[model samples]
Target: MHLKNALQKYPRLIVRALVHPTGIFQQIRQERAGTVLAYGLVIVLFNLIMTVLAAVSGLTPELMLPMAIASVLTVCIGIFWLHLFVYGLGGRNGVGTTCRVAVVGLTPTALLGWIPGVALVGFLWSVLLLYLGLQELQDLSKARAVLALVLVFGLPLLLLALLAAAPGFSVAWASPGRVTWV
Candidate 1:
């Protein structure tokens, strides 16, 4: 197929994946690793563009490269951590399936994450997609999927939120290599 036709399918895949995660994940194992990597990179590109636009408005545009780097690193780390959790929860589908689900789950946040309040909604939707997709792709029970999601994302966010909300929160030793949390 031509590159244009292949590229066109991604937008449709994004919509279809969001609406029917189970259907998409059901066939995830049959998908090629190259195609999955391309899809993930496309979603990451969307996320990077949105992040850069948001930064350009009021935040530091100078941080664009760093942000892009961090975004890619985050996806890599997220995939590994999510796969770790899925494996712990008795998921035997290997990292490729988990990788596909992770990329598919990112569609909502990648598409609309720069919209301020809508960003939260998009993030929640993305989380939901991840949860559903994990269950389907890993063949895990609902409870196990919830546990994995909570462990991978929920607890860290809760801690971060709590720390951010605390009065007079400060990180004292933030010179370089190490830092303390709130």
Candidate 2:
């Protein structure tokens, strides 16, 4: 029922989800597990496409596979971490609900990620939507909601730092087919 409504209403929902997420918060709350997973898959596909395009534009094509893999992990695992952080901060939303909000909140990123300078607009847009979505969906105070948003956006940088600091960690493209990571 909710899925049918979401599918029928997705065109308008995407706009509301990106610009004024609170307007769509109730609709997202009505989503079930399958609908949420569908949203997740859409986000993942967007990330993959963006990464590939960035790679092809001479930004380390050799590392495209690793970058794509990392993006997927970040999307999936990061959502769980976000849920736990929100819960610990006294948020009452369930994991599924948070995941739904997160995925829907990423609509801007998915749509604008292909453009270089414009992509940053999508990133910042998603960040704002995620913050508002957290507040609305989790019934959180402003402070806790900001903290949750920080965790969601900051986790990627932390992971990158860890990977860069790992033992024998190095990546360089010596040539078209010769990439080194050691």
Candidate number with greatest lDDT: 1
Candidate 2: misplaced stretches above 4 Å? 1-7, 46-66, 155-179
Q: Report the Cα RMSD per candidate.
A: 4.9, 3.9
State the displacement of the C-alpha of residue 43, model 2, in Å, after optimal TM-score superposition.
4.7
lDDT string for model 1 (1-182, tens) is 65796587677678777677667666555667787788878887877877777777754344444656676888889999999999999999899888888988888877776665677787888888888888888888999999999899876799998987789987765644245665
Write the residue-wise lDDT of candidate 2 on 1-182 in tens digits.
Answer: 96687566666767777666688787777766786677667666867777777777765444654756775677677778889888988888688778877787678777776555777798788878778888888888899999877776677789999999988889887776577766
lDDT to native, each model: 0.79, 0.75
Per-residue lDDT of 28 in model 2: 71
Per-model TM-score versus the true fold: 0.78, 0.74
Number of the top-ranking candidate, with TM-score as the measure:
1
